[model samples]
Target: MPEQYLKKILTSRVYDVARETALVRAPSLSRRTGHTVWLKREDEQDVFSFKIRGAYNKMAQLDADTLARGVVAASAGNHAQGVAMAAQRLKCQATIFMPVTTPAIKVSAVRNRAARVRLVGDSFDETLAAAQVFCEKNAQ
Candidate 1:
């Protein structure tokens, strides 16, 4: 890897919401594969999703006005949860657009994090379209 990219990654502010988690050795997998194996415990994160790092990093870069205007995104699962968790931590409103086909548990999780869940469309593509409309209307 290039030194500059490595430096940027090491200096990233994603640490505010995501801590440095140690890799746990996958002993059985390592033995079977004849190679040392390790697994990152991103599940240990507050959102139980690795996507929180990227979500928080991007949102953290926004100006206060933008954040105050709120965030809107389209996702049925992990990304939705991450955005919801990040928004809650930042004290901003978040609207997650998900397909009506999404499971109740997933919807409940996002809502639990204080983000609004909008169940639109029967498929993910339609759900994304609905979120895009929100972005265009809100100038996001």
Candidate 2:
């Protein structure tokens, strides 16, 4: 990629994901599983998770035309907040779909990211389907 594009990628919304998240070697877990087990301590993320990386990367890679149309995604957990925050930083409209069963805390976090939040179905699968339909209809 060109320097400009590389810069965009490096400084993309995903960049906001803290690199400080730990990579802890877990000998106990490794022994239990009978294999090497290194925990990617995403639990330490600013939002207390790692799903934000994909969310930011995906949104940041959008072409100018796609961004003009906005973006939508379905997620019940960490992913929802990631997408919301990334969209907010990119100054693009974002719509998030989550199951009605999602915890209030997660819902509040997504809202904090400034994305339009919709509590749709009873399960993640149903929520995802609804979000996909919505995205397709909106050409997102």
Candidate number with greatest TM-score: 1
Candidate 2 on 1-140: residue-level lDDT in tens?
69998887667656654556778899999999999999989887766788778877887788888877888888887988877877887888888899999999999998998888999999989999999999778776
Q: What lDDT would each prediction earn against the true structure?
A: 0.92, 0.83
Give the runs in model 1 whose Cα sits over 4 Å from its true position: none
Q: How does residue 41 of candidate 1 score in lDDT?
A: 94
TM-score of 1: 0.92
lDDT of 2: 0.83
Write out the backbone clash pairs for model 1.
Answer: none
lDDT of 1 at 108: 94
Candidate 2 wrongly placed segments (more than 4 Å): 1-13, 31-36
lDDT of 1 by residue, 1-140 (tens): 99999998988878888977769999999999999999999988888879999998888888999999999999988999999988998999999999999999989999999999999999999999999998999887
How well does each candidate superpose onto the true structure, as a TM-score?
A: 0.92, 0.79
